[model samples]
Target chain A: MSGVFTEEQEELRRYARQWLDENAPLEAVRKIAETPEGFDAAQWSELGSLGWLGIAVGEAYGGSGFGFMELAVLAEEMGRTLYPSPFLSTVVLGTWLVERLGTDDQKAEILPAVVRGDHRLAVAAGRAAVHDLVARRQGTDWVVSGRARFVLDGHTAHTLIVEAAADDGTRLFLVDGDAGGLERNPLSVMDLTRPQAEVTATDVVASPLGDGRAGDAVDHALDRAVAALAMEQVGGAQACLDMSVEYAKVRHQFGRPIGSFQAIKHMCADMLVGVESARSAAYHLASVIDHDPEEAAIAAPVAKSFCSEAYEKAAGDTIQIHGGIGFTWEHDAHLYLKRAKSSALLFGDPRYHRAVLASRLGIE
Target chain B: MQVVVCVKQIPDPSGTYTLDPETHFLVRPDEQVLDDTDRYGVEMGLQIAQAHGGSVTLVSMGPKGSMQGIRQALAMGADRAVVVDDADLKGSDALTTAQVLAAAIQRTGFDLVITGTESTDGYSGVVPQMLAELLDVPALTYATEVEARDGKVTINRQTSAGYDVVEASLPAVVSVTAGVVEPRYPTFKGIMDAKKKEVEELTASDLGVDTSLRQRVTAVEPAPEREAGVKIEDDGEAHLKVVELLQQKKVI
Candidate 1:
């Protein structure tokens, strides 16, 4: 009951597909991606109002109180359409932590407002890819000072969950994005769909996460985040397959449709295989997150590895199948390719995750 | 303000179908899904019920696999669902479907009945009218927009010449097109809570109806394939050859 999604989940996926088809079409995505804030504010607030922001959140805090699979279904739809938003950064990382690790007071203060779209949040796992931030114990107070790069949605997020190395161990600190001496500079990215920023915290005092179990909490959060990102990859990969298949059907070359060619047909078939495999892997991770976190140590990385590579290959093949028209800037082919590349590098790429999987299996 | 939305179970055509040329019967894998065309009607029903503090009930008729379509609607916050399944009901025509549906609606009282203009599979566009006749109510077809006030419902029905506004008394049947209203995604909480929602199952006999095939499909054949076309090698004479072929085929 907890892990498997019922018929309701199917309806939810259909609803999301329709919503994104109407509200977040490719043109809307293109227009929104050009902005620094990233994503349409109206859609963001609309999602919050629709209770999407709280899909996995508990009912007591204005959430739908569902498991991770519901959220994965939605993220897949959004990724399929390339809906540009900071959903993962704010919802999975910030809102989830506030629920999982924040104090009762903090949960009462933050989760409700986040669910209502009154606040935007971003989380930084120090040195995830690039980290220079340092936490120093000045008397009894903790100050975070240094630069954290590749902070997802950091440019517009009003709240921050900054991880830093303290005197004892690495800990998480909640800091206001607009705090004195905190500077957020947006980064130039190949994928404008998901914006990243370089954050500089200069002697900023902040509150420690509840009970200072930051290590365990951060580990759990990262595992879930990896799995969530894999779901997004599956969505993007499936979209590429759809675009390629549609193109192959109508695109004519020699004497008939290019789909009649054996080479093109095999490419499309290979894409189908990739898309199906990745979907299975990502959903398996969702189940692990819900019912078996212990299995996630192995499942999350395996999913991320398989799905990220599949998405990249699928997007690459989409461009290849579209030929000259796909190479142009005027086409949507390149945009999805860029997103596939960007997401592949995020959290950890296929190589890194494969290493994690192999190490966990004691193969090395 | 009780509303009943008719949903049809369609076998996803993407699945492989087993062809039986002997009996002209095609056995399709039972990956039954709610007809995409009916989603708008269901959304409208749920929306109206939410605004009016009433209940939305879904009705479907198919094989036992029709439960999949029923559960899909129930998951979308429908108060309840009723599925009528009978082997004898197989191959029943649109009017026969109306008889079965009207009987189910009688047990589950409703002020309004809704359906898609046509099922995705059949596309006959006559079930709603047949149901209206069976229930003795106004039949509003091809509604692109709908609104209710007092005891009357107004529909902006689509026609070849733009749209026509039609108002009918309460307890009328409406067949809406695909894009009437944006459907809502079922929330996770709603999906979980759907377990508690009642899905009453009945049969043609229980509805006091004789289920027998009225219309018979005699044959099933794939469409004829097109002939291969001429191919011109991409040299200097390719343009002249293309023009000659086009002239020969009378394409231009």
Candidate 2:
């Protein structure tokens, strides 16, 4: 029977699952999460060497030259493992923005480094409908001033792509991480696997990403990022369901396994429905985004909204199913719960995306 | 060096299995995957080919439409594959399998042959040796580590106590053990490129091999279900009860 994914994609999924199971198990994730950087440089380089860091990058830029579908598979696997890395910030947001809007010279210089895992990138843009940073033309340069909150991996990125309001329209500017007038404070985030930061730019000298307005390009990149994040949510929801089912089968109470109970069985069954539905939505969005940009505009918000709620409900139900053990700090359930909550709020929460979807469908 | 790795497509070990009552053979599931043990041999072959400036080829003998597992191994960087698929091969013994594989290997022209010590489902553990004997080459079994240089193959053969360093000339068969070397995951490029790689399919008649079975299963029986063990709840004198039970079963 034919499936939504290709055989090659399925093989990629298996390969990724096996690699993550060995290299980034829960123990390694916990160790990396506890570190201040919240990422392991060695592991990041290893991922680059394995060609995972460049799955979606063009071959001209020293990447694998595959499309976003392969990236979705990698993202799902990363989410399943709770892999502690700046992949979203660096690969999804930063590199995409540059590749979408950067000049040929910029792409030639920066993308190779990003693919090699030698340089990291972050986008200093707040939530949708919000533009905090402002840029003004200076002598042969642009000076940016504003505070952008919830900047994913902002503190450790080698370069920062700051979305700022210009005199004519909104624009994207590239600033060095250690620019003289820039300050980044890492936030104490709920999701330990993904780090966020507050970036304050006080007249940081920057270079314009492209010669003109960047609103459309930024929106396209955001749509792609939302689709990618939805795929991750699907993986997280599936993992929560798997953990619940496995636990229910082994944990006995009152001389019978909890899974044998109708109530527990129903809960597990509901989780399965949510996870599979979310997976369908996410996979559909990934394909549309690769093939048709017009279809992707509508599919992105639908997937984002559905997957966010699915993951949130699955994570919450996972905790309830496990009873007291799931509540403890030692267990891995809370980690996923935190990830679910944080990821739902990352690009935009379910409510926000639902509104976006309604407007896109001309219902609002 | 032209390294050839013998791979098998077996039903997923995670799936439930049953024996066909009348035929006394395994009712193989629709889902099949590359045997876990053979992955080591493929990885070893790839490493040898990479270091010695050659390409690795995969050879397998199984029912038709079992190419999914072969495709998986190809995605792991094998240059090409040859599959011996024919209906007549059903219930073929290990020796018959070796004969068919030897023909395919000869057609592919291999300087060295690598295989897993045993297939997971059958556990015959004799196909590599049989192939070696049929092809008139020295067999090196249970290799934990293998090296090819100077027109010879050297291996650290695994044993119950320790490993033995064994060496043989070119055109040898070596069976590698699990954990010999970590298998590399297929990269996206590798997966995409595998689609265009060559997969030559042949039948038993084309290979000039007889499909008659030398060994066959006469009867099949399900293993007896395990009985529940006696449970002794913890009490103040639970240790004494446990000791008494152990003494009743055997002397403490």
TM-score of each: 0.82, 0.91
Q: What is every candidate's C-alpha DockQ against the true complex, given to 2 decimals?
A: 0.37, 0.65
Q: Candidate 2, residues A1-364: lDDT per residue as tens digits?
A: 2287787888889888988898989989999998988899998998888888888899999998888888898899888878889888889878888887899998998899999989999887646323389999888789999888888888899998888988887888899999998998888988889888888989999998876367677777888888889989998898999999999999999999999999999999999999999998998999988779889999988999999999999999999999999999999999999999998988888898899989989999
Q: After superposition, how far is residue A185 of candidate 2 from its true place, in Å?
A: 2.7
What candidate 2 gets wrong by more than 4 Å, as runs, is A126-131, B219-252
User: Candidate 1 falls in which docking quality class?
Assistant: acceptable
> By DockQ thresholds, what CAPRI class is model 2?
medium
Give the Cα-based TM-score of candidate 1 against the true structure: 0.82
Which candidate comes out best when scored by TM-score? 2
The clash number for model 1 is: 0
Pairs in steric clash, model 2: none
